[model samples]
Target: MTSENLIKYTQLFINNEFVDSVNKKTFPTLNPASGQKIADVAEAEKEDVNKAVDAAKAAFSRNSEWRKLDASARGRLINKLADLLERDITQLAKLETLDNGKPVGDSEFDIQCSIDTLRYYAGYSDKIHGNTIPADGDCISLTRKEPVGVVGQIIPWNYPIMMLAWKWGPALAAGCTMVLKPAEQTPLTALAVAALAREAGFPKGVINVVPGFGPTAGVPLALHNDVNKIAFTGSTEVGKQIMAYSGQSNLKRVSLELGGKSPLVIFNDANLDEAVEIAHGAIFNNHGQNCCAGSRTFVQSGIYDAFVKKAVEKATNRKVGDPFGDGVQQGPQIDKASLDKILRLVESGKREGAKLETGGAQIGNNGYFVQPTVFSNVTDDMTIAKEEIFGPVQCILKFETLGEVIERANNTQYGLASGIITKDINTALVFAQSVQAGSVWVNCYDYITPQTPFGGYKMSGIGREMGAESLEGYLETKTISIKMPGKL
Candidate 1:
């Protein structure tokens, strides 16, 4: 698909209507692959955020059609949205590839994942239930699960539609009205999906999308007193700031899926060929912009040299070009700032004495493209080894024993995911139990499904994203106790 064929939706979606920002401000959303302007998007500031919050609050009120509808009806509406998403997956994927600079194939995968996530949550809309307790002394007691009044969601540029699904699915399934702030860099897909939500017959003010920068739209959403909850997927620093904002305001419930420097360990007994492929895809997928990318790869000393050679070969052979081009496995970074950050981190890796195996430089002149970089002989103290580079840079660290590798892997403050490639079941089980990460992939990497809960340990933020656990974040529990007179 060409840029001319792609559709642009630039207005803020509020109360089921596309409208200009209150201040009439706008910003240019760029095509990161060519450093060109894609469209002029509406820029939402604090005033716009307030408007969205008010809309959501009105939709969540008792008298509103959204709150008065049956839970099954709500589920049907969500399912209709999912159906619409599946029908328009092609256009949505192209828009995502154009706006976010991810490969078209990867964008398709993201769209499919989003569709699956929405369907999964739609199945649970009416099934969200509380407990009924058998009480004593003729008193009946029960618990009810009710929706949190209004939610504010802020999503990242990478996997924009998928993250929107992750946050929106549970919130909608739990019957919460929400105002979403899509990342300023890539708001096209979110705006498009908001239109789909409206088409699927969602009530006015039940869903809203506000596209703007973090400091303006995001901060106001988090700090809004009327918003009962906030869900965010982004950097650990920004996640922390949102948590503080929540506390300083109404102590709104906050759920965050933050950064990671996840470790992928390969043992000597593993299948060498399979391990090499998994490790390469784990670190280099989506140009390694994934928060759960296995950036720190720990290989056994017995096969470290061979693994490094094979990894370098794979990185050197991978295609990096336009996201829309055929057979392009790697694409440009999201923007110039992200491109500069990745380059700086790669330079730090070289200066800190990590051996650059094969690729380590920028690729093109006009856009933000980086070479698939591999650093061998990397120590734990190196800047690249310790930081979440969020780029297609791999740091291979050699380990002598299982115990040592586990210790080294758990040393990082952020623990989102880990992977172990080993033939021995005993070793896999031991490592899985000991790792501090939220998800441990045995003989696999990045195998996420809608049924599985995704989150992290330590500073990797709070709460889960996908699965049934996510629905709980958007719901509140109320217990009712009744006293009955039996023989009076």
Candidate 2:
């Protein structure tokens, strides 16, 4: 189907129906590829958030149909949702590419990952049972895992569909109802997914999707008193705000997978070609609009010069243009604002005396496309080195020792992900163990799987997102004790 045909739903998805905003207001969503209007989606605000939350709260009630459903039934519904997503992968990927300006292939990859994530959590639905413990003094004790109830999940613009699955998977598995506020920039696919959820036989008020700006829709969802938990995946600044909003309102459980300026350490013993390719993809994938993009590349000085040369060649050869175009390795940086931020950091890198290896300019006049930028002889204190330059800019820094590089890698206040590209198992093991980040890749970078847990350390934010471990954030463990003499 064509892109126009895929623009089927632009309204807020609440209580299993698509409806206009309370005030009948709408906002235009732009296509970052051509700087043109895709469609005007329903702009959800405080009232919308309240409406969605009420629906979710009702769904979580003790006698609600959703809560009364069996765990295996929940799993069946989740699998059905995954099936729908997989069936409509092409349409959703095109929609995602049109809205978020990522390559269609990457969007397709995201949908597959989302399906995998959903299926993974679906299997966990029946498996998430309570454990009977050996209690003291003739008393039987056990722990029951119950849903947190009425969760508010705010996903980021980058990887919209993937983030939705990441949050919805576990929460649905645990039998929790939710109101999700998709990023205003890329809300169309989310609305589509919510439609599929209804088709998958989810009860009304079990899931809702509202599309609006952060202050209007996002803030209300996070601060809603009825929301038992708030899960956010975005900038560290906004993550802090979500935490504060939870505090100001109900002290709700907050799970944040925040920003990162992760480092990739390349030892001299590493394969030069492999290291170059991995590092290139690490920072440049998704046009570098990634939370765990390895922004800093700390190369051991022995092979640093050679790696820099090959890296410059790789960056120079990358094609940047329309995400829908063929042979395009890089796309525009989400929007004009993101493009401007990347340009600002690129300038900072130049002014700080780093060698501009290649590519540091805007590619076109219409879209928000940027050159695949590379810099060598970068220092730790440079703006490009320190900040999470979520763009196609690579900063290659030289280091002397493993000890020194490990310290340098952990120097940042943010530690979401880190990587080591060395053949030495000893070096890789030590680096993986010593890294402060949540997920440390040994030979690869940004190696995320549905089975593996992913999150950050320090200012990168709190809590995990994927795997069985993420189920904890969505559930509350309650201990039950009974006297043996009280048995019937």
Candidate 3:
């Protein structure tokens, strides 16, 4: 099916059925590439959240098909979903590109990674068993790891399908039902994935996708008393709000993967060519919408000038325009608000006395295409260095020694991820160990895989996603004890 056909599944997915909301309200989702409306998705509100929650709660009830099914059966179902996702890679990539305004190449990569994540969790499904405990008496003691029941998942727009997989993979593996809310800006691929999950023979209410605004759908889902947990990947501000909502509601478990202004440090001994390319990709990937993007580029004072010049050249050469265009490396920001914010930050960088090396302006008056911006001679106090621009803007700061760079890198409130480019193993190992971020890269940047645990420290997030640790967020541990007969 073409992306157009794929986008027709824009209705709210509830109880394995694509249906209109209770109020029949809808919102138009736009294509960031052309500033055009692709489709009017069914807008879910409080009532719709209640209905979806009811479905998920019922599916999570003991004796329900989803709960009573064998562990391996759940694994098989998830694997089948992965198979279908792989089969429709092309069309899914297209949907992602159209809705998200990311390069088609990046979309394809995300689809593949999403498949890998799902399959990874599928292998983990039957393996999630508790253990027997030894007691001081003849009594038998054991523990069972069980699903945390119904969950509410709120994912961001920067990565529509990939974030869906990140949220769904572990939740499904743990045998939990969920009501997910896709970002209002990018909901097409999410709705399409919901259809695939249904085709994978998941029981009704096993998964629900509600497309709507944050205040209406997202807030209600977070505050729902029946929701056993809320797994959210978005802004730290919004994550804090959800945490507050969880406390106000039922004190439900909450796992958040929030924002970051991650750093990428380069030592003097680092290969200049590799360092330049790695630094470029670190910040420019996904148009710099990544939470753990290496926004702060700290270079050793000896090579700072050379690195800045080459970094400017790299940013200037980066291709920006149509997402589907051949050789295009950059695309529009998600919407007007994002574009405006990036431009605003770029202006602040210039206003606050940081030298603009190259490409600080928007491409045209059409779609939200931003120029790949670079700033040199940036001090730690500069706006570009202090705040997360979250754009294709690299702020190059000079550092004298390892201790200084590590201290500067750890100064930010966000500790999602960081990187260091150096040839010396001691430097790399020491920097990695010293960084407060969740994931650290030595030679490369953004080296994320399905099997690795990904999350943040401090304000970045509350829990990990992907890997074995993610399963803990969706599971609850229960202990059972048996008394032996004294006569025996």
Candidate 4:
């Protein structure tokens, strides 16, 4: 399953089958570690988008088998899909690594997590409930949850397979037909998963994938009047554009898990080993491309110098090489634009007076690789501390008190996730309660589960992604009242 042995062609998935793009246009998905195209994916045009949307709409409308099926039946179908995914994890992981330049180990974990997520949501399918209300008269009142209809889901390139599972799981469990659009950089795994889904007995047109550029296909999907909802996981800037399109076209319900500049605060009383381990896991995991990654780290002033030194040493020791290697811990960014963006942000940090601790330069000549970078003496106002670099770069800032660190951590345009490393229960409780971020980790960072609800606050995006609450996003609440013959 290595890139050398991997195949190069993948067709679009529409109407529960592999189909060619209407225009027969194709785009090469490059391996960021080697700067070489590993696969060619169908480039979905506007007509392809229309076909996918039409398929999803038909599946969602009345008389369609997908919408006619009960939640339990949907859950069984998705669980079958999860089983198929588990059987092919190895091959799928290799494809993801080759297509996205993430290490094979990380890709395996991501694919496994994707399976768990689908199963988790599938188990919750029948758990979606409605409530009855008491009335003053001899009347009945109740509320029910109904599917939001056709959903246009867009997944990011960093963790394509996992994010797709995150969106598709709940959307499908809620009985909403979906039109998925994976990032153009890496679409092989998504297409492969769609094939497995078809084999799992999902009805035709229940799930469709259209792969194309953002402007042409993505924008059209977001602007389609028939699309009942838009769910996106990407940058904040692009999230804004999608929101605008949703507003202008259909005013559809939109759920976004956008960009994050999450903070990891280490108190003086924290466990040094645990702090260091969690700090590394927070930013270095997935090459720091995670939206909920604790990218902005703040340490107590008393332990600032020692913490920065140890963190830099640990970060610099990260293995950056071929993503296909088994022991490689870090790999290249997703593409050339991502690499250039990380480099430019590093330059901005240097120009703005942050001290480069270690590993700031680019690595290798053939790929879009960046050395694991760490910056010290980063104030809260610096660009490195404020903006998300989204590479394996850590910005270590110093803080004095718990109150001060909480305030500084909350002072950001993004509120996706934050972490606290401290042994004191009172301090951890206060910080967790006071932090504005959606998720707060106590001694761990970048921990995700299909049971825990994941999302953000303020500019970080809207709605929740996991847990029972996620089912709500795909459903609309309707109130029903019935009058009795006799008055109260």
Candidate 5:
């Protein structure tokens, strides 16, 4: 590897130290751009997971430094980590791009978002408060919010560093110690950040990162009896498995941000150019690996044909090449398996009678790349419309009216995000209210801010990830009662 893109910190980070796994096992993390092995990451199995959890549990104990630290002091430490991350943004972003195959610009944005997330939660550390209730004159009643002890967080590969911030920010802000499992495919960035957490003077075991496969390390962390909570961002299937493991084990508090087949609606009143641009970004960003990607594009009949033409042109012109290359908007899929799955789903779309308007084949001889594929004349029954393809593929379906489109959009097992492009405020409001997704964007798509709460409804996952609402998930409510003397 070049000096600018060298891999660093491949060992498991436990108790604020980089250490070898119990078995000393390692897995090759690939550079998806060249389909080459970038580095061998230390693999954490059940034994290593147990060690990390034990450390986290101890750190979270009342007598430990982490728990004994004042809430504002904890916030300061998290802010310090954010400052450290800001200083190393370039290096961390490069590592993310090298390992995850997203464009460098995208990686930089992710790092900035993560830093902002840390800062946001730092502000909340001191503000997390309890309430005093006026009860019967004879009694004093109050409720306090306390951290949920040790937490196990499993973050997905698509947005590795950002997802880490989503899970780590609140858990730490609430005074909880955690054992984090970065996705095996993209563990480099998470490992690098653990060093920063140590540098920021976080107590040993306050933040631990164990890199390994889901079954080996992830399941153990999720099922660990000492872990007070499990926060995960991944596929719906795995989210379900984690929930089941929670039930089978300690019934830990579980929070999930799962999969989505989000819809982007284009009403006739929308600016054709703007709608086309937004829709292209909604699905094609991150190679469509986003859990809340707007994969389903619904267009009103008045602009149906026009929208398809412009969308096809945009997808065809999108550059699919090396993520590090200048002006390359689209990058390779995460790995060969993901690329193959995307291609298979594309074929199914064609078989199911959706018109393949443009690119649907893999690109280049090396690495895992797929052309930005688009399909027109898609019906609700098509596999591409129903399933979370999680690739750079967009399915465009025509609708006649608002009521019909709302029904069609809500008819899915996933309800993570939805968007509408319309100039009419009434139309946007109606669509936003009627849509079943957790987040609804008007005249925009995929506009995420750290201040806004993000999550989903129905099968899309159980709880919120960002904003004040997220802090509630990492905390527990305890009610206190004291009887007063009759002399009062």
Candidate 6:
């Protein structure tokens, strides 16, 4: 196929145009579905990162046309960008599919979500209000919400496009210039997004993208003194490192959406068919690479066997092949390293005495794919139950009562998202209120809207994204209190 025919792959986008890297270092982004090299992307070094940051800093400091534009003008620009995205949805979706190993249709849906997010945040820009404090004397006092200047946004490989929206939608609407570092594995869509923004008349240096490995580009961006705020979506380990760098370097404001071993609980009262389908989606969608994959399932023992049997049967029937191929439900891991980590976790589950019910081996020859493994009788202590596999692996554990299940689910170090499937309204309400997760899905999994705030609790993450609160995270609150000289 010609390069144009391939939906994914781009060189680089920096400062409102496609550009070449200064280092002349290039890396191949692979199609995970077939383990085939898709396209060569310019590898950005620390100097390149510095350049991007400097450009963003300059843009933010200049009070340029971008800043001078009124809130309505900013909103219009974002809406126009959204319109451009919708106009070329297919191309963007195809690029996401090829690079991220997700189905094209799903990629399109993600693009739609991105569009909605931008529009939502755009509407919020003018509405973000300052609070006027009632002063004791004849002084004017108010708090204003202003952008934190230059932002360094680093997105993870899984759901790269969506995560980018989560970071940039609010940051952009808040009038912060941003330097984006997309995960090396999935830079194609990000590059496309940068192009769209430029086409929509965003000023040069308002947004820049540099695709490179995390340790080099990501690290420097987080630690750069010029970067006033850092927003990241990735593992907790990396989140910690970002925090450490931010503390040591600039004391920058940091927002992270980290890893999760989110739990899905199905009570005996749940409609079996509905529960089973949502359960599969919770765990297996995106090949189970979801940060909130619902990896740990707590099913009521009254219907545990039936649930597990149906879950395995459905997963086994799922088509696992090339992501670009029609009807394929699952794709390969992002790379070999992720595949190996998943396999080791599966083995650890077996060693820990969890019953390996079905599917636990590499499936294909060319790509880093694993079978849709399911484990039953999983204890809370099992590695599969604790650590994030970031693959298509499901571990189901039985619980007798709500108390027991809730306890087991919250016993983890991470609390990103949790799901409950119960026909009883009271039960659903209880679980929703009591669960320690950031989001509790009832009767569904992976359902997200642009207006709702999403993030995590505890080690799962810090700060919120995807809602008006996200704008707050990108801004600084300052209180101006003027003392009254004559009244007191």
Candidate that would win on lDDT: 1
Clashing pairs counted in every model: 0, 0, 0, 0, 0, 0
Residue-level lDDT of model 1, residues 1-488, one tens digit each, is 46676765789999999999998999999998889998899899999999998999999999999999999998899889999999998888899999999998899999999999999999999999988899876888999999998999999998999999999899999999999999999999999999999999999999999999998889999999999999999999999999999999999999999999999999999898899999999999999999999999999999999999999999999999988898999999999999899989999999999999888889969889999999999999999999999999999999999999999999999999999999999999999999999999999999999999999999997999999999989999999989887887
The TM-scores, one per candidate, come to: 0.99, 0.98, 0.98, 0.97, 0.99, 0.96
| Regions of candidate 6 where Cα sits further than 4 Å from its true position | 5-9, 482-488
Can you tell me which runs of candidate 2 are displaced by over 4 Å? 486-488
Residue pairs in candidate 1 whose N, alpha carbon or C atoms collide under 3 angstroms: none
The sequence of per-residue lDDT tens digits that candidate 3 reaches over residues 103-158 is: 99999999999999999999999999988999879799999999999999999999
Write down the worst ten-residue block by lDDT for model 4.
Answer: 1-10
Task: Name the lDDT of candidate 2.
Answer: 0.92
Give the higher-lDDT candidate: 1 or 2. Answer: 1
Candidate 6: 10-residue stretch with minimal lDDT: 1-10
Sliding window of 10 residues with minimal summed lDDT for model 2: 1-10
Candidate 1 error regions (>4 Å): 136-138, 486-488
Which digits, one per residue and each the tens of the lDDT, describe model 4 over residues 63-141? Answer: 9898778889999999999999999898888888888888888889998999999999899888887899996777799
Q: Please identify model 5 stretches exceeding 4 Å from their true place.
A: 1-5
Whole-model Cα lDDT of every candidate shown, in order: 0.93, 0.92, 0.93, 0.89, 0.93, 0.86
Error of 3 at 285 (Å): 0.3
Alpha-carbon RMSD of each model: 1.0, 1.3, 1.3, 1.5, 1.0, 1.8
Query: Which whole-number lDDT from 0 to 100 does residue 96 have in model 5?
Result: 93
Q: Residue by residue across 1-488, what tens digits does model 5's lDDT show?
A: 24244576999999989999998899999988888888888999999999999899889888999888899998999999999999999888888999999999999999999999999999999999899999877789999999999999999999999999999999999999999999989999999999999999999898999999999999999999999899999999999999999999999999999999999999999999999999999999999999999999999999999999999999999998888889989888999999999999999999999999998998987989999999999999999999999999999999999999999999999899999999999999999999999999998888888789899998999999898999999999999999987864
lDDT of 6 by residue, 297-336 (tens): 8999999999999988987888887777788787777888
